[model samples]
Structures are given as structure tokens and as C-alpha cells.
Target: MNQPPLPEVLDLAGEHFHTDQYATYRDILEQRPVTRVRFYDGSLVWLVNRYEDVRAALSSPRLSNDPTQQTDIDLSAATGIPDDLSEYFRRNMFRSDEPDHGRLRKLVTREFTVRRINAMRPRIERITEDLLDKFAATGGGDLVGAFARPLPLTVMCELLGVPEEDRTDFQTWSQHVVESDPAFAERNAASYRSLFECVRSLVRRRRDEPGEDLLSALVEQRDAGDRLSEAELISTVFLLLVAGIETSVNVIGTGAFLLLTHPGQLARLRADDALMGSAVEEVLRYMAPIEMTSRHSLESVEIGGVSIDAQSTVLINLAAANRDPARFEDPQSFRVDRNDGSHLTFGHGIHYCLGAALARAEAEIAFGLLLKRFPGLELAVPTEELTWRHVFMRGPVALPVGWR
Candidate 1:
């Protein structure tokens, strides 16, 4: 049998990757479904672009999420995370495979169930209202800073029993960890250290006091048996903090931007309140918060006719897959009532996002109440003037909007 041709190599970094990512993905999906792309720090990975390829790559057993599985790469060093501290940061379910992944996921699966998340709706609404009340008082501000960032951060912090006063520190530390900017690279280790230390303190407190929060529950499980370890516990909290907060923040911020920019969809949604759920799904698909996720190929695998060697890194472009024309009708257009829910924004198979339900509920409440309260909401500045965060996740750094 003949081997497939090597994938074309391309550089994807700086302004183009951050600002016009969709266009770049489109070109790759149309031409090179699988290509090797060099990232900011000069690390190379096989970039899978098409919908089918991305979906297959995400669920393929051949692709492993474990950093330790990579034979040729020091993932921690490549990503600027210290080798010694990498285990604490990467021990969570998202970075695991097989029995360990299942074990870690099972521990927190119940907490994020649709039922549990729905029960928190009332509290989520109240939080939204409190933030909106402040926004209304000011009449306009950076929606991200004033509302989008805080609402989810507050929810995650409260869920983890993080003290109110400690949230600022948590936000700063998480931002440093998630930001993809080269400037933020040097701070990654320090941020991870801080986050681990903070989580350790919280874990100790939860073990002693045992509050009604998820951290307390996790601590109970850890103490009850060997079901959970100290490192895993800390990592779980870290995952929930960074993953839970950032995804929802982007959804709220980018969702708002999408609605405001696409007035027709916004108007359609406003006219028919029933479209809120569909609108949320569309926002998720159209502007995926987590753009791409990397996995280590456990063995040699063929994707989109390109062969990936054993222990090679593969980056599945979720944003590209979500908007692939082959899967979505008018993939470029944002429609409130598209009602198509097959997008891989929450991923698929074993590693599907654990916080999907909570993120959706928070977004629905945030947008529903936001539109209801401020019917006149519009961009505070020209759309081109708005800046996006160049991070592991994609969202506006600040969404300035005014309801007046």
C-alpha cells in the first residue's frame, strides 16, 4: 500500500490566527483538511480542520489526552508549564484517558447533571439580575469586565466555596494560565503554583469545615476512600475554575457581540422569546469559545488522508468543525432559530465538556435577562474597535455596550 503524502506545513500565529481564524480555517478545510501548523512558540501539531475529521479525531481512541503519552514532546515545556508542577495541572479528567478519565469524570458527573444545573437556575438568575442592576446604574461599560466575566466567575467561585474576597486573585491567576499571548507565557508556572496553593488551602478548609459547596463534597469523597486523590482534587477544582469560568465568559461576551452585530437575529430572538435556547446553541456553534483542543496520538492514525505517527500531537480545530459547511447549512450565517445542535462545541465521546449544561443555562439566563432588561442595548463603540483575547479560549477582552 502506498503512504499518503505529508501534510502541508503552515504557520498560524499572531494577529491573523486571533482575528480572522474562521477564514483561515475555511481555507484549510477546503484545501488541506489535515495540515501541520506551527503555533506561537514554534511548536508544530497536525491541524485537523474539516467537520468529519475533527469529530473523528476528537472521539478516536488513537488520540490520547494525556501529556505523558507524547513520546517526542515535552507538552509542559512547550506550553510553558513547569515539568514538576505539570502533573497537578494536567491530572484532571480533560487531560486523562481510559479508566482514570472515567473515574475522575464519575466523581463530578452528578454535580453537573441537567437536573442539578436546572436547580441552580433561580440562583443564576438572581446573580444575573444583580450584575445587570449594576450595569443599568452605569448605563454602559465593558460587558466582559462588568458582567460577562464576573457572573460566571462568581458562580464557579461560589460553587467551589471560594471566598468572595479571593475571587479577584482567582480570576487573575486563571487569566494568566489560559491566555495564549507570548507575553503571558512566562507567568504560566507562577499562576499554576498560585492556583494550586489556593486550591490546597481551600481543600484543607473544606475537609475541616465541610460546607455545602462542590469542593466540600469532593473533599468528603476524597476522605471517604481512595476514589479521589489530593492531586486529583486540586486539579479538578483547577479545571472547573479555568474551564467553567472561561467558556461561559466567552459565551456571554461573544454571544452578546454576535447578537448586537447581527441585529436581524437579535430582533428575531426578541420578537419570539422561544428562540432563546436555539439562539444559545447557535452562538455556541457560530463562535465556539474553545477554538481548538490538542490530543496525543496513542498510535499511528490516518485522518483526512494524512497519516499521523505514534505519539504525535494533533490539534482538532473545534471552531473550524463547528462552522464546517458540510455539516451546517449556511455555516457562515448566524441564525437565532437554526435549532441545529450537532456542533462539537462541547466536544464528543468520553471527553465531552462536563460543564455543558451549566454553561448553557448561564448563557440562556444571561442573554434572556440582558435583552429583557435593556431593550436598547447596542455596541458602545464601532465593531471593528472591539478587541478579542488571544488565549486558549476565544472571547472579547472587553465588550463595551450601552443600553441608552
Candidate 2:
């Protein structure tokens, strides 16, 4: 089968933000689950859009997550970002393979475990109530700016032992790294400086006077056994700060938007507490935050009738795969009662999101409380009128919602 043209990939991305690409994604999955396309820098890569193909691609040992192994595809060439910014990305767990990925992931997984996350539920509920209370006083507000953004950032800052006074700066820095457009190089540099300096200061403070937070725990572990390196410490903080904030914010923000927009789905979820977990899963599947993640083939592999060469780049379209009609019924509709867990939003295999439990806990508290607190909640603006961030990891820029 002939591969999709370069423009098709770009067109798909463009269509995704402006309109739902459910039909296009379904067509791609059915026609060419593992098809090749050119990235922004004009390098060709296999783009997988089917759930099974994406899961296989993620788990395949023939594929490597380490960008260092992808010498043929320069980070700058592939992403249209300066090579200097690549160093910041390369140091992180997201770009690492096993042993390294496992090591970094283990350092924080204990804190993000299901038990710890669930334990934080009451506190999360308190925090959600407090934020909603403030919003209630204002009559109407930008839900994303007023509630969604601050809630996750506050939780992450608290987890990492970051001081309250310094969180705003960190939030600004992290956003720059994720949305590094208009001027990718300069924004990333600023992000890196803020992040490194903040983490370094926190690490020093924790070393001197350890606290009860997760960062303090990690610091104590490092000091006691010399298990983690200085580089790992900073890199782990970077991961937590970036991943912690971006994923939670988008998940909560987008999930609420979906619920509000789909009244029938919202009604069902509100009527039954038993459906909240399934609602959360459907939310993750239907409005996946991270659209695509890249991996490189370590050896030649055949997938979906195409032979992917060794060292070839492969991009898993999480959004596309989750919406595959093969695995989902009425995939385009935001039905919370669907109760399917076949989503790739948290990824698959070993590279699955370590913070999945924590994110879900936060979202559950967020949406459950949101509906209860604002039973009269309704969108202040039309769906088409609301602005959306035009990026791979997409979310509503501002959700103007009103309630009595």
C-alpha cells in the first residue's frame, strides 16, 4: 500500500485541533495502521494509529526510546528546535530506554503509587472545594486559569516541596517548555534555567533540612545509599514538574469540558457514582492529552504490511489509536458511560505513565466535585467559539464556564 504523503500528516494535525479527526483517524487505522509520513523537518517516520499497532510499537524491543540511538534523525531536524534544547530533553526519562527509564521511574513511582494517590483523595477533595468556593464567589470565571491550572501546579509543588511563593515562576517555566513555539529556543532556555535553579535550590534545602514531601524522601534515599546521581536528581525534578503539571491540567480541564458539552453523558455520570471510574477512563480515551510520542526502531520490523527499517523513527498517535473504531463504539461521542479501558492515553507496556494513578485521583476529585458544586454549570461560550491550543498535546486554552 502506498504511504500517506507528507502533507497528510500535517493536514491531520491541523484538522485535529480545528475539528475532531475521528473519521480521519478511523480511516487511517483501517487503511494503514502503520504508515510512514514526513515530520516537520522533512524526515520520514512510521505513524501508527491503530490501538493494537500502537501497543505493539510501544512494547516492541526492536524499538528504542533513547533519542541518542537515533543519530540519523537530529532532534533539531526532527522537531525544528535548536540542538541546545535537545540536551534538556535527552537528560529526561521520557527519552530514555529500560534500566535508565526503569531507574528514573522507580525513584518516584512509590510516591505516585495507587495507595499514596488514593490517600491524597481527601486532601484533594478539600483543595478542590476551596478552589471551587473561590470561583463561586466570582459568579463566572475562566475555569482553566482559575481552577484547573492552579490545582495541579499546587499539588505538584506541594509534592516536590517547592515553596508557595515560587510556584508561579515554575508554572510559567514549565508551560514554556511544553508550548515552545513562536520562539522555541529562547523559551526552552528560560524554562531550563528556572527549572534547574528551582530544583537545585530545593535539593540543597532538602539535604540540609529534610521534610515529609516526596522530594525530601528521594533526597534522603540518595544521601543514605548513593543510589541516584546529581544529574538524576535534577532530571527527575524536571520530569515531575513538566509531566506533573501539563498532564493533570489538561486532563482535568478537558475532562470537564467534555462532560459539560455532552449533557447526556454528564447526566449519566452524575446519576451514578459507580460510573465515575469508567467516565474517567472514557475521558482519557476520548480526549487524550498527549497526541503523539516517538520511538526509533532498533532493528527492522514488519508491521501492517510495511517493513520498517532499523533506526527508523516511529510516532504513536495516542489520540488516533484511542479513537480507532475497531476498538470503540461511537468513538467520536463523549460518552462517559462507555466503560472501556482500551485507551493509550497513559501509553502501554513499560513506558506507561507512572503518574497515571495520581492523575486519575486528581481528575476524579476534580470532576466529581465540579459537578456537585456547580450543578447549574454551563459553558459561557459556544464549543466552536472556545479557543484551543494548536499543539500535539492539545487542550482548551480557556474554558469560560458559568454557574449560579
**What TM-score, over all chains together, does every model reach?**
0.96, 0.92
What RMSD, rounded to one decimal, does every model reach? 3.4, 2.9
Tens-place lDDT digits, model 2, residues 1-404: 55353244543335533465655566677666777665545556778778778888888888999887875555653333455445554666677888888887777788888988888888888888999999999999799988999898888888888999888888888877776243465566666676777888989999999889988988887789887777677777778888888988888889989888888889988899789999999888987877788888888988766898888888888998888877778787887778788799998889889899988988888998889989999999889998766446678888999975
lDDT over C-alpha atoms for residue 152 of model 1: 97
Global lDDT for candidate 2? Answer: 0.79
Separate clash counts for every candidate:
1, 0
- Candidate 1: misplaced stretches above 4 Å? 1-8
